[model samples]
Target: MNVLLQVADTAGAACVFLGAAICLLGVVGMLKLPDVLSRSHAATKPQSLGLLVVLAGVALRLHSVMDLATLALIGFFQLLTGPVASHLVARSAYRTGQVERGDLLFDDLDAQLTEPGQEEGQGRRDSP
Candidate 1:
């Protein structure tokens, strides 16, 4: 029982370290990436992953089932919301033409923009 507790503690520490590293990398990616779309993409995945991993670590170290369940709920909510929020932000950027089109490999949205009746980015480009 003692050994099991020790093992759980060690695993929790390792997981927390890994989660911190992933979060650091994501921050670096956001800073280094060229545009809003790229930064948004970078920010979402690792952030969610880091949160889940850190939550798992905390769950492992925690004794109560209730605490673990709380962590699980938080992780679930993070997983559900992170990508949706990222997608919405990205969609807003794309729709408003804030995305750098030349950097994109291909664009299905661009095709839609060219459709005869479509508005085609009725967004204003304000320059600083």
Candidate 2:
């Protein structure tokens, strides 16, 4: 095998291993975290990083440029959507009272957060 190909294969293997490890760590965090917000953080950051790295590894291992382009597109979409999706889920959980207040150090959104369908100037929350 050519020296460059050998080096690339080694690098790709390393990326795959590291990516898998990061993804596993994220899964562990999601399971071990005390609340919904922390779990959402765990699910997004490391998981997205892992997904990108794994996609890179797959791209490196593939023979065709078309296959690599597909991997790149998948990784790009994952990067674009992962954090947004997690944030939406976390925000919905917090609004629905699923988050643990004790775990929160500070809440800047307290004043701005509002219930759905609430009228303007209704204050921070809608009365139950």
Candidate 3:
């Protein structure tokens, strides 16, 4: 039992460390990314996964029922809300035309904007 507990502790620490590293990487990516949408992707995906890993590690290190329940709740909230928040941000950025597509190979939004039937400058309030 003692050895098992020790192993779990080590594993939990490793998981937490790894998660923190991932979150740091995501932060770096966000800073280095050129645009709002790409930065949001970096933030949401890695940030959510890193938090999940940290919560799971906490659950493993905590043997008490209440602690585990709290950890589970944290993980559940992260899982349920993270992607939804990211999607909302992305969609808002898209609709608002705040997203940058500098290196895009093919852009559907560009095509839509250039289509014949679309009104001129419908979303281009800032354009001269």
Candidate 4:
């Protein structure tokens, strides 16, 4: 029992350290990336992964059910919001002409935006 507890503690500490390192790399990527789209990608993907890892480490260390539940909730919200926020940032950058159209391999948004008979902002209207 003592040996198992020690192993769990060591693994939890390693996970927390590794997660922090991953998050640091993501910040570096965000700073080094040249464009808004790439930067947003850097901002979300690694950060989300790192956060989940950190939460898992916390869960391992915490014996309380409530603490584990709270960690799970935090991880859920991070997974839910991170990519959505990144997508919104990238979409706005593309709309505002910050992203270079020529750089994109598949321009689906361009097709939607330029569809014939659709006025500017008309295709995106939420309500009739």
- Top lDDT model: 4
The CA-based lDDT of model 3 is what? 0.82
Which candidate, 1 or 4, would have the higher lDDT against the true structure? 4
Model 3 C-alpha lDDT per residue in residues 42-117, reported as the tens digit of each score: 9888998999888878777999998988888887888899889887887677667886666667677676666666
Model 1 clashing residue pairs (backbone): none
Expressed as tens digits, the lDDT of each residue in 47-79 for candidate 1 is: 999988898888889999999889989999998
Q: Give the residue spans of candidate 4 off by over 4 A.
A: 125-128
Best by TM-score, which number?
4
- Candidate 4 TM-score, C-alpha based: 0.93
Per-residue lDDT over 1-128 for candidate 4, one digit per residue giving the tens place of the 0 to 100 score: 98988888888998999999999999999999999999999999999999989888877788899999999999999999999999999998988899999999999999888887787565565566
Better of 1 and 4 by TM-score: 4
lDDT of 2 by residue, 88-123 (tens): 898778767898766788876554655476654455
**What alpha-carbon RMSD in Å does predicted model 2 have with respect to the real structure?**
4.9
**Cα lDDT for residue 87, candidate 2:** 85
Q: What C-alpha lDDT do the candidate models reach, one value each? A: 0.88, 0.85, 0.82, 0.90
The collision pairs in model 4 are none
How do all the candidates rank in terms of TM-score, highest first?
A: 4, 1, 2, 3
Clashing pairs in 2: none
lDDT ranking from best candidate downward:
4, 1, 2, 3
Give the local distance difference test score of model 2.
Answer: 0.85
